[model samples]
Target chain A: MRKNGVNMIKISAKNVDVFYGKKQALFNINLDIEENQVTALIGPSGCGKSTFLRCLNRMNDVIDICKVQGEIVINDFNINDKGCDVVRLREKIGMVFQKPNPFPKTLYENISYGPTIHGMAQSKQEMDEIVETSLKKAALWEEVKDRLHEPGTGLSGGQQQRLCIARAISVQPEVILMDEPCSALDPIATAQIEELIDELKKEHTIIIVTHSMAQAARVSQRTGFFHLGELIEHGSTDKIFKNPDNIKTQDYITGRFG
Target chain B: MSEAPHTVKSYEEELKNLNSNIIKMGGFCEEALGKAVQAITMRNSDHAESVIKDDEKIDKFETLIEQQVVNLIALRQPMAIDLRETVTALKISSDLERIGDLAKNISKRTLLLNENLPKNLVDALVRVSSDVQKQLKSILDAYLDRSSSVAMNVWESDEKTDDLTNLCMQEVIKYLKENEKNLDDGTHLLFVTKNIERIGDHTTNVAEQVYYLVTGKYLEGDRPKGTEPIVTGEK
Candidate 1:
């Protein structure tokens, strides 16, 4: 539902915190992400941005010592609830990582794996269509359509990242969490991925965590700045880059301090 | 927010250089206006020639400031207050350069005047010039202090200069129609009055930039303007 204005709130986190044994990684963070818009999370290293991102789809649960607190609500249900099916919740939320990682299987297999496991296709022809459409959506179709049988890891770093992105979209997820997706690529490859992100936001709600303030300013409609395990500021990207309210945010973005 | 130095010392030095260059150019503009006024009121062609000759320094400062601004944007990729600071430096320098050019134009017209003028006409012109100089000085102070309130004060004071300019224009027109011999000096006086009025306008533009640099929002609504001289529609 719409909370502040015209944009619908896709995900709302209220007083969310994360702890790894004795150390608290994140303090109370309250942020509402809008649908079909890119939300960027930026801060210095070890600021809990990645931890906060992992909490969205219970990715943090895989860590034996990590404990998460508070409500992460999407559409009227809390994804953090004990009754929530993590596998089902993960199916609705896809993730891309900092490094370009593609499975050891063939390129075609990489795109089909998620759908095959999720039972999204009923026949061979349906699976092939899903593979083709996912590759095209990832903007890697023309480069790899003729070599779908080749190992996914055999591709270039940029192409492999796109392949991973293709794999993520194969399940038709509603939200995409990218953690420094372009950090390992060259400038040209980074630009291509940034363009893909702009196009992807038309169909998916995107939340990106990056140390590059320029990237956050370029791609995000909204930006949140985290510092010392606390969310220091969050607002429109323009406002954050132009005139952020908090002193810590201004200093961080302007390179005065971390 | 606490004023902290940038992590990279070089970037901080570059920004400091830009600010100093702007202040230097502002000083030159103020000096040019002062000299131009002295030339006109005291009938000193030497002072007028010096003001015109020194216009090139102001122009060079504009070029230097613009180059630094471009380099900052390309290399530093400044954000937030730094971005606004760079942009306003470019804008304020351009306005200051225009002020220098206007002051030079007034000095150029001074060289063309040979006939003696009445004391009241010269006094009115001096009043306009003095008000514009005060406005320019206040804007420069506001810029250095990063004070929006000071800039707002300068912005609201433009009407005073405009009123004085209008009065000077009327005096020149009356002097011209009073006698055929007074036409040449009176015509030159009219141009000088216009140049001084334009300098006042450029100062107001600098005031607006200072306001925007200090606070990200533009000064809201229409700028307060003074009444214009009435025009005769038809014979």
Candidate 2:
């Protein structure tokens, strides 16, 4: 909802461009993200949706050939700045990937790892509280509370994904990025994650990249459709799926063309 | 544009099947409307009975078309224009089905007047019949050719059928005034005229659907209503 008909901006990107050495991946793209809203990025394979998502948190910096140029403001910070502390920057923004990758430790340790590394908990009791709260927020507390000492890797595919989400929330990040976080899970698990996403948006800004249009339609307030490395259209999820302004967006969503 | 010919041919075939089924149903509706009118004009009770019975075929089309669309949505997960197209087909089929009901209603009135159709009522029924029949045909043309102009033409001209119906009702009343013994025929003719007018209304609705299917935008405004002209001084 808009106050006084003006949306509050949580993340803003301007003229964002990405290149793999000489081969350009993303064209100049501008997107305005509203506070406490789930923004979904959707496109065909290799349309650079994931690449553009990585630019938000500077995940592309790890790739030797990938280079991103843009102004991305997370609240008041120019995260692309050279002097910006990469370690602290990552703490403020947490990410869940296409597959669930949990730490090779107990479920309790998986949720406590981030807070412990960041010095968020001063005592063992504080650490335990963080673990429990994060797991509850991820909606995995009841399912795995009995198995807190069990290895995170020993959980079901859905349970493991929720563990990763809890781990992301453990540090109390301001924003969460999910890169097709439910792609490897079953329908029941995908539905659980979608439900968890709706709940998390109350406290954290969420941006998700998913090939499932239905998933994007389910979770996002604002949706951006990318094609051929360009932002084809960006609008409310209803308009994007019901009556998109761009023909390319319509074609891709309608399964008419890639 | 041309949808660039979908990657999956079977999806295309499924969509084609839906369109063909709708067109076939439209043909059935048109035939019923025309036969109902012919039955009254020619004083043929058999033709009137056939028109009433044929409505079952249209109801079947409604069931079949609705099921196909539901399955297509579930199995194919159509989106954007394909989504709009499937929904529009459902809407049109529904209108056509209702129009079939109106045609059946008209034939029932025809059965009541099979032995006593007033000369003026026959002429008026013929007039309303041709007017609404032409509108239905032209709207179908718009649907098949994806022509909004034709659809708009049908939309704009709906008032003429309403005017003809009003005039037919007036004639029926005048016939009753001349012969008090023919009160039953006048009452049935009054109903028949209204039925024909409603047929025009449903045809107009189909025209609006055509406009949406072609342009992907609803005709933005209140529809042109065919108001019933007030009748007075009845004994």
Candidate 3:
């Protein structure tokens, strides 16, 4: 892990590559995901945006056939290092997925689960405070406050996605990786989630992988355009949309092709 | 994508060429006005003839600069200040060319007045011609230098030319009223006065362009009393 309070990158990828067993899924990737700003990774489907995102906190480690090469330095530690603590690393970097995967437990316990696993709470009072604060940060506290004991599965899909966000926030991660976090939500819920992302950027560095160009244009300060597992161009969002230097980037933004 | 550097350099070159061509055309028109007025006052038919010939060159330069401006707009896709400068150049060139045309008109009047005339009336026209020539030169200088102070001077002096033209018109009317035998001479004198008045108008047009070139804004109608000074910058 990075030394406390020192100048360390939030996340840095150098010459990174990913493979699902034999077939390579990503080319040599180099990027710096900065602190407290949104960096959007945009590309067509199956272009390795999600695969690259999963490498940050070792989410790809679950797939036995997948192998990742190169360093992903978060703080001072590479999560791919042999002796690195995967659980502690994951606790510092949380993720919300494409679909809201809320647990079958009570809404209160869903948030408390991470802190309990990490031994962060000393007693019931501390655990209850963590749950309430996380829900508040996720902007779901008012609706769920009266039914803290209700099952998380009973909430609507939008609320469940927010519950997953609340669960992720409960761990107090330094960085948040969102892989199409609002893909299943309606327009209103998507807007709420986008606003939530905007607010979260003030505290945590965010890296989002999205397929929607307009969404990337709306939410990101910097946009990286990927094509066929390669980063074709990357620059300020305004330039990428209005006067892109690369033809591929211009084509993608202008709807000539993906 | 890879040609960005080349495109930028080429656009810069085109802009430079456009500016230089405008300055060159302005110089040619200024020269034509000087010779045209000199021919009228000195009664030198050769100088008057040369001024008429120079008008053709001025027209050619105006046409060339206008084509360049149009091509720059269509090809370079200029925006912001570049757009403003290109449009301003287009307007300025046309105004300069019209000033050339007025100079040609004065040359034509000079040729007509060089015919047999009363010496005193000829002397009066000579004085008026010199004064109008000075105003034209100062106005052109103000435009070239983008000097609003000089432009203001040109604006103030326009009234003097108007007063002289009115006096000349009155003199011509008196000649017509008193001597019914000299009706044709009086009519030509009236034409000479009208030509001088038109030259004054062209001088004012140049002053207006000076104001616009310096401030990138139009000045029209009555002058604003105690208005805030316009801040000058490249548009």
Candidate 4:
């Protein structure tokens, strides 16, 4: 169904399967990530939530033995097509990991790294403008405006995460993938990152892989419960948390088992 | 012992049983309140004695439903609206149990005020008890139907019961100040009125639970706005 003038199928996957050489990691999965909204993928430790998340941007392709099947269409373009520009596709899709892996450089240089490498910036002044805008978009400009030359590693854990987000936005990506981005931070820092995620949804479609159901409940608009290498249930956050349709989804949400 | 195929009942059947049990318990409590009021108004200690005898049945019903609620939660693991319904049943059953106690208190008062009060004071007490009885019935109806509008109406009716109880208390205290002849009877009358008012309050608690069961939102400290204005002196 269409909502708020946007197509319902922002990203569509049909009968998608992934294999790591001899072992199948995902089986006949199907899901859709809507536009300008956060969709949380939650399951047990090895239920392929992170693996499926990686498939969205073809991040799993780097693993030598991994092979993906079926079509993953984003904005009417099939990403699995051979002629698809993987580099340009990645430029429009960004990723953040479990740990806040900021580059070992100044905050300004870190945020500007993507645009500079992509040749998106014409001059040093343009790169500076891009850095400032990206930092502002990530809600970190004021905290590090005077410390632009300071090393990103000098900042605290939460600050480093926000800096990483600033770097993601620096490239002007359409979608941002967060793989347990707040798992390393304290509650207060997690709350800050969650609030930033909520704000960032106004401009970017986000897909988060979270081990914490409470975090998923707090930050996500939609949630997909994964189980045993399959997408079990995907629905509105309220339904998923309150009255999931699937028994396994209910059991997992209520802590019956992993 | 054989496993016996683990004869499991459907959740719908369990929910139906819970609803019927609540209604049955509510009916018994309603009858107890009615008879207790009659015993006070007619000076018939036998009716009060019967109500006191019926308290045991209400207690048993409360325990039965309480166990069922626990079983429902343990077995069904209900979510969302169903979860709210189970939690509300647990709370409402406890409130009903307390209302049963309040009925017992009224019967005790009836035993105390056997033949001492004058006619006018008894009339005022009868009016207060009757108002409480009507409000309690409406609250029970609201809960069973899961009607927010009816629940809101019952909540408003509780204020009327409160007003009647206050007036009854004021009349009793006035009579005490003037004569002091039936002070003990007046005090018992006050206790009975307070008990009935408390029953009204508990019924409103049940009504609030029904509201939450329907809406999935707590009605804590919230009065529904722009409801029909409560008509006074028109019970």
TM-score of chain B of each: 0.95, 0.93, 0.77, 0.87
TM-score of each: 0.97, 0.93, 0.55, 0.65
Compose the digit string of candidate 4's lDDT tens values, residues A1-258: 357876466688888999999899899989989988899999998899999999989999899999999999998998998988888888999998889999999998898888988999999899889999989987789999999999999999999999999999889898999999999999988988999999888888999999988889889989999998999999999889776777778667755552
lDDT of 1 by residue, B1-235 (tens): 2399989989889888988899899999999999999998898999999999999999999999999999999999988888998999999889989998988998999999874778898998988888988888989888888889999999998888878888888888888888998878877888889989888888999999889888888998787788675332111
Q: Of all true interface contacts, what fraction is found in model 4? A: 0.16
Candidate order (TM-score)? 1, 2, 4, 3
Q: How accurate is chain B of model 4, given as a TM-score from 0 to 1?
A: 0.87
lDDT against the true structure, per candidate, is 0.91, 0.88, 0.77, 0.83
lDDT of 2 by residue, B54-126 (tens): 9999999999999989998899887776777788889999999999998898888878774756676789878
Better of 2 and 4 by lDDT: 2
Report the lDDT of model 4 for residue B223.
Answer: 46
Looking at model 4, the pairs that clash are none
> What's the i-RMS of each model?
1.5, 1.7, 10.2, 8.8
lDDT of 4 at A223: 97
Q: What would you estimate as the lDDT of candidate 4?
A: 0.83
Could you give candidate 1's per-residue lDDT for residues A1-258 as a string of tens digits? 245677898999999989999899999999999999999999999999999999999999999999999999998899989999998898899999999889999999999999998999999999999999999999999999999999999999999999989999999999999999999998888888999999999899999999899999989999999988899999999999998899899999999993
Q: What is the alpha-carbon lDDT for the whole of candidate 3?
A: 0.77
Worst 10 residues of 4 chain B by lDDT: B1-10
Candidate 3 residue-wise lDDT, B1-235, digit = tens: 1112223567767766877777787787777777876775566899888988889988997899899899997986553234445776787788778878877877776787636566666666766766777887787677556687898887777777766666566666666777787787677667767777677766777677666655545676763222222122111
- In the order shown, the candidates' DockQ scores are 0.78, 0.57, 0.04, 0.13
DockQ of 3: 0.04
